[model samples]
Target: MGTYETAATLDFVVDAVPGLSSTTLGWILVILAAAFEFLGVIGLKKYSEHKTLFNGFIYLLGFGGAFAWLYFSFEYLQVSVAYAVWIGIGTAGAVIINMLFFGESKSVGRIASVLLIVIGVVGLKFVS
Candidate 1:
């Protein structure tokens, strides 16, 4: 399908979701934004090492997507809470990915810290 057609289909589907709350949509957007943030950080590392146009473009796209989704999420969540959660997800995800893939330090402290961030994110979600 053409890009426009695909986009139109997606729009229709999103609009058709019955009784979707703005808050729920915001949470979804923020979670997606955080994933993109992780992608952007990885792309940045690649771009830094290779300095290739493709890598740079990928990084830019990821970063832009992250920010755009985060902005949309603000419609349903508090700005501070959404931003914190996004950062928390991105930070924790990056650390875990590094530990898994890069043989980064998986010390007790680091693991504990990541867990703390996760807890904080969950707590914020509940309180908000």
Candidate 2:
């Protein structure tokens, strides 16, 4: 779909869900979107390694859910602010999850950088 069509659909969805434009709901949706974004990245990795139809389907579901939630969140939050926060959460969450679960690096500098991303995300939310 074109950008206009996609935007219209997002509007419709937001309108259909009453109270979704509330600050609490918007934040919840953004957080959920971030979680799904992490899941989507994990699915991408699995798909790359295994190349299975199931993995690809999981990836699509994760990404689709992430975008849908993020779009709904924009009804209440500024798009630029919301997007940056969402991406920040996703990036940090992905790295942390990988470190804890996937046995990725646990270096101090890497941990500190993730902490900085979290701080940035919090700052953006506060300013917005």
TM-score of each: 0.84, 0.82
Off by over 4 Å in 2: 1-21
lDDT of 2 by residue, 1-128 (tens): 54653342345545678766566667888999998998898888789889999999888888999998999888768899999999999999889888987789999999999999999999998987
Backbone clash count, each prediction separately: 0, 0
> Model 1, range 1-128, lDDT digits (tens) per residue?
65642121123334778977667878888999998888887788789889999999889988999998898777678999999999999999989877986678999999999999999999999999
lDDT, model 1 = 0.85
Taking every candidate in turn, the Cα RMSD to the unseen true structure, in Å, is: 6.8, 3.9
